[model samples]
Target chain A: MNVYIIGIGLIGGSMSLDIQVTYPEAIIHGIDVSDAHLEEALQRQLIHQKATLQNVENADIVIVTIPVHASIKIIDEVLHTVKDDALVIDAGSTKEQICKSIAAHPKRRNFLAAHPIAGTEFSGPSAAIQRLFEGKTNIICEVEKTAFSLQEKALELFKNLGMRIRYMDPKSHDKHIAYVSHLSHISSFMLGKTVIEKEKNERDIFDLAGSGFASTVRLAKSSPAMWTPIFEQNKTNVIETLDEYISNLQEFKNLMLQDNFEGIYKEMENTNYIKKILKGLE
Target chain B: MNVYIIGIGLIGGSMSLDIQVTYPEAIIHGIDVSDAHLEEALQRQLIHQKATLQNVENADIVIVTIPVHASIKIIDEVLHTVKDDALVIDAGSTKEQICKSIAAHPKRRNFLAAHPIAGTEFSGPSAAIQRLFEGKTNIICEVEKTAFSLQEKALELFKNLGMRIRYMDPKSHDKHIAYVSHLSHISSFMLGKTVIEKEKNERDIFDLAGSGFASTVRLAKSSPAMWTPIFEQNKTNVIETLDEYISNLQEFKNLMLQDNFEGIYKEMENTNYIKKILKGLE
Candidate 1:
């Protein structure tokens, strides 16, 4: 079996690692814009060979894992280039527009839009690791659009890699992900921005930062090239989440101003239920 | 040596655990308002015996680990009752008010204000664990205000717990901690509140919440009983930090509205420097 992995970064590079282990007969071809990353993936054994988009015609499966801003055109190009019998998948963080863009294509039945919710603060080939998707949830949008033969191949890969599948519509996926995933990134980035701004005048301000600050600001280290497109694609839902978040923070500040510790206590206690929800998810 | 641990919750109980192992000959007396906590501390072997405020006179060290709202009066009461040579320390999150409250007292020389930057979301006696302070920074405010002999006893305990000391003025400690510590809690709590509020309308919203969301919202699980007083005591600084955080979010929203992806990318890229600051902290 031959697999073409476009954009050999964290997600794609990691997929190559697991694919190699899961299917020993598979020859993985790495395609990336960066020569350094492609060579790095080759040296790290994340892929068997370095290939361009032209080599995708020989692939049994083509996995596109580029930034969301470039995903639609690239995925369209890949679908237009690959064999009709082959399965094509794009693992962009946002699915709504990409799914809509390919909805009327002749090879629509050969495509799958799956987003695996697994990553780290780092990026690129060096950030990839084996078993990154093990026990992670892969949200597959419009699975019914994919041909039965193509769907079976993707399912087999997910099964071998120990990933569970959750079917979601493109619209609902973007909306819900905006609240959970996208909003957190904005909050964290803004937090890091605020603290860094304050630390400028108060040189020793960071010395007082504890594990809490580290945890909340951890996502601020995410790749701008990756997250910028995500926020841009899901702009509406992200703005809605940001509005609610900003208002909630304003309410908290007002409570402090009013000397209403009781109200402040209730606000936090209500949100404490998140602990149980997180525990249940775990 | 006699150690009086007032308020047998996360902070006090954990200190009891370390003190027991560090000073095997010393007896740990748990002094808490909750009878259940006293009994639980006894059952968990976190304390050697249960005692009250009146017994503080026989103490070599008095640790006031209650809420910051109640700390001033309790520390004053403990200081009033304890022997002149005994070191009376209050580990309040905010230090300025607590230090000023006892500045003119006859036993002011016996009082020490320290804030240990170590805790978990869990509270009460059952949440206590040994070596919690190991390698953690203990911000000591007004270290020079305490009598030399009394400060020596507290220093010995810090050394035995494997904690380091950073001597900061009370005002600076409170101001800096407001940004690093208190502001993060508000951000996390507001994020949790925002998502939970959205989940009410969009059920299964949290199903898409990844490790990023969880990491960003983890501090929401912090006890409101512990945090409300912190926000109340450090009201000005907390509000200033909140205003800055909210404005950053607003600015990001405006950037999104204008479709300025470049501006959004720059915002996040600038804050990416937090990674290095946090790394240096570690």
Candidate 2:
């Protein structure tokens, strides 16, 4: 099988490596707008070759792994260009916009909207690894809209990469992802900005940062180009989640100001339910 | 040398283990308000034996690793009881409160206020590990208030644990830590609350939590008992830093709402300075 992956950054680059490692017989071609990324991907051997969309016409699978805005554009472009039976899947963070973008395409049935819930703060081809998707969940939205053969092909590919699959509506997927994923990036980025602004000496931050701060601010290092569109595409849900996050912080602040130790402890105790949830994730 | 640790929870318990391994001849005694914690400490071999505050009076080194408020109370109870030459240190997150509480003690010069800027989300005696302080910064506040000989003893102890020591004024330590440590905890806890509230099904959170979300929200799993007083003692500083964090989040939210892609991208791009800072840390 031949796989063509668009946007050779972290997610796309990783998928390229994972696929190549899992199935050495599969030819992997990568596409990216950044010449630097393509060069790095080649240096890292993340892809067999650099290929354009037109060159991907013979591919058995075409994965759209671009940023949200570019993902929609590529999905539309592929619908007009790829073979009718080729399995086209998108590995975007949010699903609604991408699904809506290609809703009217004639070859929409060949397209599957999937979000592999896995990544690190690092970006570019150098960050890609062979097992980035192992033990992670891959949520596929509007699966019934995809042709049965294409859906099966996508499922087999994800399963081969050691990922669990789930089905959900595009709208619900967008809402849930905004809370779990997008909000985390926003919070981390803003926290990094806040500390950097107040602690003017960057050296002090480096010397003083313990694992606690490093872990909490880890996602602040994510790619801006990839995330900006995700925040924009899922605006309402992201804003609602951000508002609740701010309100929760404010409530804790008020409790601290009043020296309400019992109140603060109870609030944290309540949120400690996250422990059980996190364990469940493992 | 004999070491007496007043509270055998995460910080204290971990210190006991590290000290035992670092100084094999030292006999460590543990005391805590939580009898259950003391029991666990003994069963885990975190301490050689359980003892009371009276055990501290004759010890070569006495360490108070309790909450800020509780540390103050313990200091008052044992200030006169301890040997004049015994090097006493408190490992509380907030230094100002604990330092002030012991300012007028007749044995004030024996008390050293130190905050080892290291910890995990997990807590209790079971969390103790042998090398928690290795390669970590141990900040000592108001060291001038400590007698020169006692200061040397305390510094030697931390040095033996492979910790690099730095000195700062208690007030400045509290303020700096508010940005580096306290604010990160609030950001993480509130993030956990927001996601849990937004996604009613904990299963969805467990299934969909990517590494980005998991890393960013990891600190939310910290012990409420340990953190509640840290926030309480550093209330003003925490409130100030939290307000800055909220405003930063609001700015990002506005950028998304207005579809200011360039602005959002620039903000996140600028915050990516964290990568350079983190690189320097390693």
Candidate 3:
């Protein structure tokens, strides 16, 4: 089997590593815009060979793991170049734009839109690690749009990587992800910005940051190059989530100002249900 | 040596475990209002004995690890009861109020105002773990007010527990903590509240929550019994931090509305300095 992965950064690079283990007999090819990333992927043995769009013609499977905007621009081209029977998947965080771009394509049945719900705050090829997808959720949007045989092959691959699959329409996927994933990145990034701006003394922040601050601000360390596009692509949903978040903060502040400790405590107690919801992710 | 820990929950319980390891010969006595917690602490063997307020009279060292409001109400009584030579310390998140309340007490010289900058989201005796303070920072406020010998003993104890001590004025400690620690908790709790409110389908949230969402919302799981009094005690500083945080979010929303992708990218890129800051924590 021949597998070609384009934009080989954290997700693409990590997928390459896991796929190599799952399909040892398969030949892997990588395409990335950054020469440095390609070099790191090679040194890391994430790919057996480096290839471009023209070289993916014979590929049995092509996976696009670039930034969402880039994925939207290049996914249709990838579909056009791959073999008719080949399977193509795009693992972008925001799926609506990418899925819409190829909805009317002649090779639409050969493409699948997936968002593998996994990652660290770090980025780049060096950030890739084995077992990243193990026991993680992979959301497949517009699954009915993909050819049945190709969907089966994709399912086999996801299962081999130890991922559980869930299906949703592209629009629902974007809305849900905007709340669960994209908004989290924004909140964390803004938190980091607020702290850095208010507490000019970096040493004080370093000295006082406990595990809570570490966990809450961890996402602020994510790649701007990747997340900026995600926020832009899902702007409406992201903004809606952000507005709700800000209103919640405002209400909390009002309760604090009014000395309504009971109200504040109740708010947090209500949200404690997140503890149970997040247990599976741990 | 006799050490009495009042309110043996996460912080106090964890401290008892570490202190036992550091000073095996010392007798550790615990006092908590919750019988269930006291029972759990005893079952976990976190204390050598259970004690009342009268029992603390003979204590050579008394550590108050209760909620900040309770700490303010009871610290004076604990000070009045302990031996003249006893080194009394309170490990509350907000230091200004606690320090101010005891500033004029005759036994003030025997007390040390300290805030150990460490904790997990979980709480109670069950959450207690050995080495929780290892390689973490412990801030000592109003150090000059503490008796020289008592300060030395406290420093020795913190050192034995593998904590690095940094000194700050009580006001400065509370202000800094409000931003670095308290604000993070608020952001996380509010984020959790917003997402929970928006995503009615708990299953969707459970299935789609990625590592970033989990990290960003981890602090929401913290015990409300512990945090409510903290917000009450640090109201002014916390409200100020919340205002700044909300304004930052509003600005980011405006930028998103305008499709100012470059502005959003730069915000996250600048906060990426947190990567360097948090590395020290790990």
Error of 3 at A165 (Å): 0.6
Model 1: per-residue Cα lDDT over A1-282, one tens digit each: 999999999999999998998899999999999999999999999889999988898999999999998989888888888898899988888999999999998889989999998888889999999898888789999999999999999999988878888999999999899988999999999999998998887766687888888989999999999999999999999999999999999998898889998999999999998987787444
For each candidate, what is the lDDT? Answer: 0.90, 0.86, 0.90
- List model 2 lDDT by residue over B133-157, tens digit each: 8889999988899999999999989
Question: Which regions of candidate 1 are displaced past 4 Å?
Answer: A280-282, B201-203, B280-282
RMSD of 3: 1.1
Candidate 3, superposed: residue stretches over 4 Å from native: none
Model 3 lDDT tens row, A1-282: 999999888888899999999899999998999888888889999989888888889999999999889887788898888898999998889888888888899999999999999988888888899999999999999999999999999999999989999988889888888888888898999899888888775566568888889889999999999989999989999999998999999999999889999999999999999898887677
Cα deviation at A277, candidate 1, in Å, is 0.8
**Residue B270 local lDDT, model 1:** 97
lDDT for A168 (candidate 2): 90
Q: RMSD in angstroms, all models?
A: 1.2, 1.5, 1.1
Task: Output the number of the DockQ-best candidate.
Answer: 3
TM-score of each: 0.98, 0.97, 0.98
**lDDT by residue for model 1 (B121-209), tens:** 78899889889888889999888888988789889889998988899998988888988999999999999999998897655666677
A best-first ranking of the candidates according to their TM-score comes to 3, 1, 2
